[model samples]
Target: MHGLVNRALQEFVKDTYGADIWGEVRDQAALPFDEFESMLHYDIRLTKLTIDAASAVLHKDAASLLEDVGSWLVSNPAQESIRRLLRFGGTTFLDFLQSLEELPGRARMALPDLDMPEIVLQTDTPGRFKLEIRWALDGMGSVLLGALRGMADDYGALVVLEAEPGREGAEIVVIDLLDAQFAAGRTFELDAQMR
Candidate 1:
């Protein structure tokens, strides 16, 4: 895992919960360092341990915690850099979803050592798509779900999201665009003709 992720998690806990709680979680996780440096690679196990410790201390399920973290990553002004990077993908919700396929490559360009999870987007039909995520670590599916929801919120698009079980180490997410016009606050009308 990248240190950026750990740092973000730390920030999320500290900012949301409190610095004292973060210290307790860090100690419970048996982490030696109080601060994680961005742009560095840390043991993935450390990240898992931190999450577990946080869950224990906060009395929240790991999935929900991760989801919150993901949402925070996109919605928090403190994370504007990450939000800007994501927004660069597109001007609309659909465009952003399509751009997810290239995010791994874009991330690699910025951090050569970072190995991002694979994201595949498949169109099921008009206004619907399937996102397949392949990751080595656990608990990221929920995070992705939250991130997608946050992105939808950012675009002001109303979307329905469903998660289906996939093969080991993979997650399949289904996205349905409920209303294309809702984001722009538009309405459609029909005209009838009589003979």
Candidate 2:
């Protein structure tokens, strides 16, 4: 697994549950180092161990913790860069939903070695979307679920989502857009100087 991915999991636990909890998780996972270097690579087994340790320490299932991690990446003030990157996909929630299909490509442009989950967005009906997420690693769709919720709030869109099992180890998420103008969303400026 990429260090960035593991580092993100570490950051999520530390930022949300407190550093002591994160330390316990790290020790339980038997991580050789205190911090995951964001640009390096590590054995995939380490990633699994960390997730398992975090789940045990936090008293939450791995899926739930990963979902929270996803939202934390987007909504946390310390991780505003991630929110900014996702917001750049659209001026509205619908537009952003459509752009999810291209997320893997966009991520590749920024970090060629970073392997992102393949996302397929299908809109067979207006105001409804089906997102199929497939990755070599499992549980990313759960994370996407949290990120989707955060994005909906970011654009002030009222959306309902459901996650179901998919064939060949894929995750299928059904999204229903209830309202496009539900509330006043957080303001975003295209130019840094404007903020």
Report the C-alpha displacement of residue 134, candidate 2, in angstroms. 0.7
Per-residue lDDT for 84-176 in model 2, tens only? 989889999998999999898988889998869999998969998999999878889989999999989999999998888888988998999
- Error (Å) of candidate 2 at residue 194 is 2.8
| Candidate 1, superposed: residue stretches over 4 Å from native | 184-195
Clashes of each: 0, 0
Model 1 vs. true fold: TM: 0.90
Model 1: residue 185 alpha-carbon error in angstroms: 10
lDDT of each: 0.83, 0.91
Candidate 1 lDDT by residue in tens digits, 1-195 = 899888989999998989999999999999988878887888989998999999999999998898899889988878766767787787778888999999889988998778688898999999999988898677667778888888888777899987788787788888999864456521112221210
Compared with the true structure, model 2 gives a TM-score of 0.97
Error of 2 at 148 (Å): 0.6
